[model samples]
Target: MVKVEIVEEKDQQSSANSPYASTSSSRHSSQESISSISSELSAEETLYDRINALVDIVPPATRHRISTKVSKAVSFVKTGGKIMGNIVWIVTTSALLVGLPLALSLEDEAKIVAQEREMMAQQQGAQQMLSPGSAYPPPPGSNQTPQKGIVPPGF
Candidate 1:
């Protein structure tokens, strides 16, 4: 049962739009009321101003309750931070897991390709060694010497 009288003070009702004033009883002695009050005031208020006012006048016990609630909420939110840390480790390990095998397999494919190229080159070299005698056709009556057996390198 809080009773309020708008005194002739300048800044008295300045914070009237505050939460305490808005949420509490508006027992403001109106201009045409039983007890004729002097100044005429409008009732326009915003939520922040009201909340600030309530915080200012809150009793110690109620304030403690509010503080405890806020702390609990903060700790709950930070509980997810632990999971986030683990998630980073999981993601990095998974990426390495996927990438390592792929890189190793690609290296194997490259080795196969190189081995195939070496085999082809060796086959071409062997063919060249086996087939001799070039493009100079005997002019008129030129006699050519016969070539010998074609043995590969390590034989």
Candidate 2:
């Protein structure tokens, strides 16, 4: 509830001139002023005043129940958000802790296997170049025949 007071100053010249005005005339003027002021105040009612009047129509118990329910709903949403954040953090952390090491180990094993294969191929090529009865034809003036079933490097 709000209380408003409106004060207006009377004209001294008018009062002095109407020092002997009839009592009926004074009463009429006072009633007219009161009515005009009331009308003006009603027309200028604030949004807060209208809403407060509307809320007053509802029962107190119902308002209390609605407020409590709304508060509970807000708290539940907050809790769920926190839980979701924690789950995401745990998942990402676990992936970095476990998956990362396994991937690195697999990559290193692949590199080692590739290096071993390369070393074997080099050894085979050296042996072929040094062997007398290789896949290639013999040197000039030399009496040697090509091998029967040896495949060249390209094949």
Best by TM-score: 2
- Candidate 1 global Cα RMSD: 13.9
Off by over 4 Å in 2: 1-54, 131-133, 136-155
Evaluated at residue 62, the lDDT of candidate 2 is 96
- Tens digit of per-residue lDDT, candidate 2, span 87-109: 99999999999999999999999
TM value for model 1: 0.37
- Candidate 1 lDDT over 32-126, as tens digits, reads 35456424432665566566777768898999998999999999889888889899999989889998899999999999999999999999766
Off by over 4 Å in 1: 1-77, 133-155
lDDT of 2: 0.83
- Measured against the true structure, the TM-scores of the candidates, in listed sequence, are 0.37, 0.50
Every model's Cα RMSD, please? 13.9, 13.2
Q: What is the lDDT of residue 113 in candidate 1?
A: 100
The alpha-carbon lDDT assigned to residue 132 of candidate 1 equals 43
